[model samples]
Target: MAGKRKTKASKAKQDDLAKPSKWRLQHGAFSGPIRAADPETGTPVQHRRAVDTLGMMLASGSITAQMHEAGEIFRGLFRAACFDSMSTSQLLRIPGSRVDTLSTMQIEARRRVAAALDLLGGHESPCGSCAWFVVGLEFSVREWSMRQGWAGRTVHGPVGQGILVGTLGTLAMHFGLTPRAKAA
Candidate 1:
């Protein structure tokens, strides 16, 4: 009976091993091999130099953002690259952008709404270019808010107003979304 059981177990193991492997091979997941001659140049492509150049390109904002989703994606990836799980807000906070004592949900919802709008219309360009545009506007608004000396209750109100006004100005210039300026 023991021998019979041993035989049955061996048969089961054999059947398991004989069954077709469950793993399917995935494709195109690696960097390709180096060719002898460079097409662009009439010289052989130096693999090490090419790799170093590639790393620099990834470090750059425009190419990186173009390859990735956008500044937001880059920010997340940057946070993750640190090998820590801390939230992004905890990583970097622009001055005057922080609310002293707000709920996490409220803060996150605001950020999400802004991120959604930013991602809309396929605006996934690099921060290197767009930084000047977005941060310039943000800076102007912050200055305006400071000048206005917005009170406790109206702090959000002034910032909202500034953003709305700035966005309208941008749209007016770019898309003629609002009435075009008349020639003098």
Candidate 2:
């Protein structure tokens, strides 16, 4: 995005980052030695950006290792199944037997996605929000609840958060990422 691209000077402090700066940098949500190209000269620029949310959540103990693993798998499967399929011409409408063109791996990925949805109780399930909050960075639960008419109430914020946590927990269990209880 144009807004994300930082030029020579802007709100992001410009420094002679490496003539080079060897020190590791970590500020709030941002982390560095990111290798980016200067928009103007195409020179590699060492930069920092707000880093991984999943990692932050993991570090903060908001989610377990199992939850993180499940989230990673959920994200990886969807990414692997990206739009690599062939499309026929608009004028060429063949009446013959249609053939499935997706690769075995792609098909398997799609199956896994369906499995994930099934475990989450389908797209309409409140746990489906984990696919957004855990894997995707669309919005926070607070923002979601506000739009869903859970606004202004004292009970709603924690309720929404609990839903998200429960969602991640469900996924972890479904994927067998959770540890078993002690054998009696």
Candidate 3:
């Protein structure tokens, strides 16, 4: 007898939960209370079915237009990504700033590559944070190389390379220097 009562109570609760709330439909449709009776003639104004509203929208071409707009946006994004990749590739090539002999140039290149990696992978570069240090080193190296004429030993393009190397080394050294106040 007790088991039967428990089963009946559970069944009643399940049925209540399964029933859709009338308040949801009423409040969702309009601000005021909904009525089947027409205000002017007291005749019934038949409420259109939910499926009919969807069918009408589809028939009117609005849904298709929305879909077309969505497709266009996706296509535009895809093309834009392709263009960005191609430009980035060109910027990283043989004569680009990254390949320059200046240490600052290398640092700048690293920064750009890190940014591109982040854009592609949604992560920051570890080396990016230390780029300033690299700049200082490059500057110092270039200065030392120039003072020493290190390029003279090289077989080809020694003069130009020594200038490049020395300049970068000097810049790197300048970056690392801590300024001391001038004596009066």
* Model 3 agreement with the true structure over 12-95: per-residue lDDT tens digits: 333343333576565333223334898899997654333222133335553333333322332233333332232224444564
* Model 2 residue 62 CA deviation in Å: 1.4
Q: What is the C-alpha lDDT of each candidate?
A: 0.36, 0.64, 0.33
lDDT of 3 at 98: 58
Give all candidate RMSDs, comma-separated: 18.3, 11.0, 27.5
lDDT of 2: 0.64
Tens digits of per-residue lDDT for model 2 on 1-184? 3667656654765677453333434223566468979999999878765455456777889877887777777777776665333556656557874554667888898788778777777765666654644464435566665654323443277677677667777767777777545110
Q: In model 2, what are the clashing residue pairs, if there are any? A: none
| Index of the highest-lDDT prediction | 2
lDDT of 1 by residue, 1-184 (tens): 3554444445433334422233511311223344577777779653322222213334553233232223333334323333223344446667777635546554564454344336333233222213223332222333434433323332344454444333334323332333445210
Q: Which stretches of candidate 2 lie over 4 Å from their true place?
A: 1-28, 34-49, 83-101, 132-139, 146-156, 180-184
| Clashes found in each candidate (C-alpha, N, C closer than 3 A) | 0, 0, 17
